[model samples]
Target: MSKSSIYLPAGFRFAGVTCGIKASGKPDVSLIVSDRPLVAAGVYTTNQIVAAPVVLCRSRTPSSTVRAVVTNSGNANACTGSQGDADAKAMCAHVASLVGCDETDVLVMSTGVIGKLLPMEKVKSGIEHAVAELADREEAFFAAAEAIRTTDKDRKTESRELELGGESIRIAAMAKGAGMIAPNMATMLSVICTDASIEPKEANAMLRRVARVSYNRVSVDGHTSTNDTLLLLASGTGTPLQGDSLCLFEQELTELAIQLAKQLVEDGEGATHVMQIRVTGATNDASAETIAKTVAASPLVKTAITGGDPNWGRMVSAAGYAGEPIEPAKVSLRVCEELIYENGTPLKFDAASLSATMKEHPQVNLDLCVGGGNGEAVYWSSDLTTDYVRFNSEYTT
Candidate 1:
């Protein structure tokens, strides 16, 4: 299928450039421009050391619209104090001047290592070149996608079609991630462009719901990034999906976003298996997520999964430590349809056979039952690997 065929409700253009800020000389800057102003909404990382661009982006939304988005990979421009904020603003000012829009109408994002200053000069020149180079072509989208990479080995994107307000709405999204991906919003960076005609309120609501299920459910190292960002912009180009018609649009958006999010998780530093953890029969939905994340984030458990060991005790104990009050005696755990533990006790299953099952597929499911309730949560994650440690140990060098 064509890359742009995902979901685009309006007209938009993208550009990317290589600025030497990152250690690698590949592309390190990108531009996302709407043909016109777009109603936009964003979600940022909970990290205290928020990036300079993130702060500025939040301030300019709601009251004002956005016309251009400037982003960079390599230096997060976080924890750099006032100077960082100025650099972020300068990036926006440069883009706004090129696009002939208000500075408030321009947004900026950054990713990669933290506690670093943005090479403003390189970014400034890059933005000038990117603006003059913008083109409404597929090659531009692919190149822009590449320009935002940090450690990612490949570019990731997804799209879907839905009928809203008696018209068809197309939703297309792209993301870059490879490490520091334990989500309070992962160290991930993304800019989703849509052609759906959505108001700011509707767009905000949709973004909230999507983040909870997509970005919120993915983790790699249980560490949030200082520069995490996920922004959605509707250019009002495609069919206008509103009210109940929005239900289908929301579903499609969440699904595509989740698909992209999962792809990033699976591609984590040195991930080999994509594990899906489902916690059911919890006291409430919140409790279910607590349990799921606890089990999913356990390095010991993740390593065991990667080694193809059906260590049921590790899974059960991880849930036990999720901080949610649960009756241990009533807990149950399963891996890929094989009941490994029941009533908090080991089941009569062949360990070698189960280990074989775990190694046979790239996907593994951990089903946990807290008993007596229907609350549940499904999360996407990856197994820990020694290679993962080696990759990050010298990432800065």
Candidate 2:
């Protein structure tokens, strides 16, 4: 499959290599390096059993000072006790030495099956080869994206063009996570790179706000992973940027991030359809979001939607358990204006017609009403299927 790419910043480059880590012949380790220190920011999974690289990267990135990113696939490097930590540090140190950068300047990420050990000897040689080929930046991006995928069907990518200070600024992003999703609705890894000048503090703040509004809003099977990381680095190569440009850049970043986030859920293992759950009409936007997530996460609701049953009761029941103060008697539900429920009672509507529509479009709207809070949220997700269970049950085998 031909993949479209994001426009990377000037100083960044990437490369990938087969480290004999995975049984497959494909590349399993990758590298991304910046010629100079870049403003880097990261957001990680809330999962308690976080991977070794995630733990290490979190320690390095919050300083907002980063120069390189070392990544590996086919081994998540989690639950390996002290050995995992040592392996992660060794990987970073090897990559740092190859790239002639400080160990503190390198950020590490690992993905794939959990409770696995990385082949350090193979990984070290791959890093050496990748460093030797750092002359091509564009290839680096593609390699980086390819190196992190687990069960993804295709590479997910997005980019945006922006004008800042009479200069053209480009923000590009890529991600992968077709399963083990559901970190408040997302379990994915993404990287965004830009040629705009911004402070590390500013960039870190922007990424946090964007992640909350975008990636956190999506869900897929409600299964979060131990190694979910989203990292963004600013090159400052184009122009000295701040103010509205920064906000605009962040908005574009969020959009691109969301695109990849939703793509992950849509292509999730055994997912045949993509659904958008939009919730509106609550005491506040936060309440509306809470209500929407409840419905989206319900196994019963998702299964009903998969079968095109349009079960309104399941939707309302989810909202009822959303950990928010919501009154069923004052709430309403709708499936694309069908008015499935009103005032806590089922609204007589054309279930057959709505179900047919569900088989056509990729959108799903589930409006919940509690009061005049008028909150709204959009969550991208997929319905559960028998194939989904089978795929996950035998994934590592």
Per TM-score, the best of the predicted structures is 1
Cα lDDT for residue 1, candidate 2: 18
Per-candidate local distance difference test: 0.84, 0.78
Q: Can you write out model 2's per-residue Cα lDDT over 77-96, one digit (the tens) per residue?
A: 98888999999999889877
Question: What is candidate 2's TM-score against the reference?
Answer: 0.94
Q: What lDDT does model 2 reach?
A: 0.78
Candidate 1, superposed: residue stretches over 4 Å from native: 2-9, 237-240
Best by lDDT: 1
Candidate 2: which stretches are off by over 4 Å? 1-5, 135-137, 237-240
